[model samples]
Target: MTAAIWTDGVPVQGLGLMRLTDDGWGDSDRDPATLVQVALDEGVTLLDTAEMYGNEDIVGRALGSHRDQITLCSKFGVYRGDSGRHDDWYVRADPATVRTAVDGSLGRLGVDHLDLYYLHHRSEETPIEETVEAMAELKQAGKIRALGLSNVTLEDIRRAHAVHPIAAVQEQWSLTQRGVEDYLPTLAELGIALVAHSPMGHGVLNQNADGELAHELSRIASELGVGAGQVALAWVHQCARQTQGTVIPLPGTSSVSHLRANVAASRIELGDVDIRRLTAAV
Candidate 1:
């Protein structure tokens, strides 16, 4: 039962809800309730979502009964009403807008308070201090348990944390995409956890099971009697351990089987030699 350390001292580790609903990327035939239930039963307690993903309502419906069992996390800042394209959403992190967004998210999710709320992206128009002050107000009012930032740089994190203590930061991190590694020292210094989205390399590592990096992962997985994806996730866990920061990889999947596999990856341990081989392969 390896766990990602949160600032609040609660255990959190598991899948994200990015693909739980149909968002024009692909059709999802999976029932939201079933998906959420299966994830919980498998010990994947951290469920991350965003208003921009167009699946907050579905997530709300699914977690209505099981809300107490999950560490629910959702993001604001992206205006989803203007266009259907995911990238077309506009940034709105002003104090007024942040208030409106959190209220809307609360209504959609049927939750009075969010376990963690995030500013989906940095808005150049709005200063981070103002936005975070507003978020700190929410915490004081008991609307959110913790503050989080997504798609933010180290500098942005410092600015925001100066206003309020940031509990977590979400970034796209994977074996092939290690840019987020640069911010680990800063994150550790601030005592903020790293929530890694796309921890599977966007399925590239799984797709290239016989390729170079994947080949090494497969070899290691075979020796450990685990799947290659599990090995990759273990590498991330190892990175977090080495950096003295918590790293929780949110690998989203609509399939129940895949969800179980991803959750089980949390328990895989990569030895020193396995880590060196995997690191060199990348």
Candidate 2:
């Protein structure tokens, strides 16, 4: 799939910025600017961030004059209290909330318009149609170029698509976390891209991976002379290839070495047997 088809011409392999924040992924102290530059240097230009990450300001600062070189993406509606605790999380997709959130995101990212904007999560109280309608209005006004949905149901995609074309759907999917696989068919049928967040299964498919999954990943990575994380990323790319759809794995890392490794994984092609073994092991 061509990048333009779904990612606004940015490469299908992306970088998730959640790890740059202090909330998770122990690399908060690493320079965010250095990581961003390394990612851009390696052609991994689809940088995904969210208001929830509390690092949009860091990402925005890192952008400098390179905004046009990458696909600036961020999410809204899924929020938490000022305490910044995950336990205080909530969702709000009211039209008013949608309008306010995008503006705030824009100011933080220092961008006039977002290349892709996502409703981080569907609000239980707000109708999907209403939220999408407000997002469509944003597109019409040029506040955002395309619309996306994250952590949404297949039904939500259908209803939202009825109101507007969903450019992509971001979901957590990996060898260890395959729940998002159930929606791949619908996503492919509609020509909407799948942005695989946490494509490493939140570290479960990396060095931290255990049990049979870890052993199998180690064997494959050893044979391929690559890291287990790269094998996992290759599997994600293979998934998109099998469906003939775009699957951009947005792996987050604050380390420059790991950033380059993740981008390099996009080029690693796993053989049919290796792919099968990895699948069965998971």
Candidate 3:
């Protein structure tokens, strides 16, 4: 079994979550509450969601009576309105909005305190310091255990960390999308963990995958008797290990089989040769 690391005292390794209710991508017929329980039974303790996902209520219902067994993480600073345009939904992360957002998230998730709360994105209108200070106030008030930032640059991270210690940063990362790698060293220096979302390349690496990188991953998976998605996740995990920083990949799945396969990837230890192959493939 892969060893679990402590993120603000919460034990977690490979993270998992059900798709947001409004995303129109998840299985609408399958119950998310049951899926969350299945994940808990399989040892995937870090559950990630967002207010923008518009499924916090469903997550709350699913988390009922089992909140203590997992680390609940959700993001703020984004929402969807009637307009449907992306620009109309990016809310400013000012102090007042931060307070109101946390309250709404808590109410929706049916929890008194969140294991980790993230500022969904950097707001152009509000200073990062002010937003972080508001988060620190929430931490002081016992409303949140730790703070995180998502989809941010190194400068945003530096500014937020200066105001308050950031426990983790969530970003899109996978074998095909390695844009976040530039900030790994900075995250390591700051002693903050990296929560990687879309570890499977939005299912592109698993479907009609024919490029050199995909071919290499498939060969490795065949050799290991595992799915290609598992190999891709293992690559991300191995990169984090080599960099001396904690990386928890939140692979969202509605299928039980897929969830189990993802959890199993944690035990897939990539050797130096395998790492070299993946590095070259990327």
Candidate 4:
């Protein structure tokens, strides 16, 4: 089977659960069944999550070996409280912690193995080599199919890649958040895919980017006749494509309609003129 562009060796769509809070944006998100159906209908096969999201139960219920067909990605290294804020986060790359976390995730997700697993964030608490060692053990033992890392520097990525072949790197990269640009060349050189999580800048470029994002999104939105969100996403996709790795932008919403709009951005190819305008302004 062909692995997905973002998943390294796993096949799927990456559903970001960071903002799937109980906000009544629409009917689909409140109901897991509705969310799964909509995603399947739209051919969005990769679903993403994390232990911190507190919705793995819903995902485990929604997936149901249908997970075998869908590529589900997730991350660890961040701890969540009842309120879903990062309170007591641990960046330990210890083997025991990794084992315990993966077990908890598997139990909550109702699955044997995650298609792709990433270290949620990197810090000085644990060396990248240690983290990579623990991750390699997990992959060898079948806890996850592939390994990935998030919020890592290029040097950290290189060290981890030395220990194991990381499938993808998850980061906050959008037309609005272009921090990943500084390190993308290393990714291209290493053959790892980039999963740009918030291509819409946490809904800023589409909803409320302060100044520059606002101006650029408005112009692109008017030209595309789609929406600011769509335009911002398209710009990220174009950049990801240019870098030669796949762009998996996980823009989450409670509404099925909005999720469909996010999917549409993948198909909305911007012209050179449009790309030039958006790229230069940002």
Maximum-TM-score candidate: 2
**Rank order (by lDDT, best first):** 2, 1, 3, 4
lDDT of 4: 0.75
* lDDT of residue 97 for candidate 4: 73
TM-score of 1: 0.88
lDDT of each: 0.81, 0.84, 0.80, 0.75
- Model 4 RMSD vs true structure: 3.0
Please give the distance, in angstroms, between residue 31's alpha carbon in candidate 1 and its true position after superposition: 2.8
lDDT of 3 by residue, 22-84 (tens): 332255434576677778898787888888877788788777788888788888997676899
RMSD of each: 3.7, 2.8, 3.6, 3.0
Off by over 4 Å in 4: 1-13, 21-29, 80-90
In model 2, the number of clashes is 0
Q: Between 1 and 3, whose lDDT is larger?
A: 1
Candidate 4 positional error at 145, Å: 0.5
Q: In model 4, which range of ten residues has the least summed lDDT?
A: 4-13
Worst 10 residues of 1 by lDDT: 1-10
Worst 10 residues of 3 by lDDT: 1-10
TM-score per candidate, chains pooled: 0.88, 0.92, 0.89, 0.88
Give the Cα-based TM-score of candidate 4 against the true structure. Answer: 0.88
- Name the lDDT value of residue 57 in candidate 3: 87
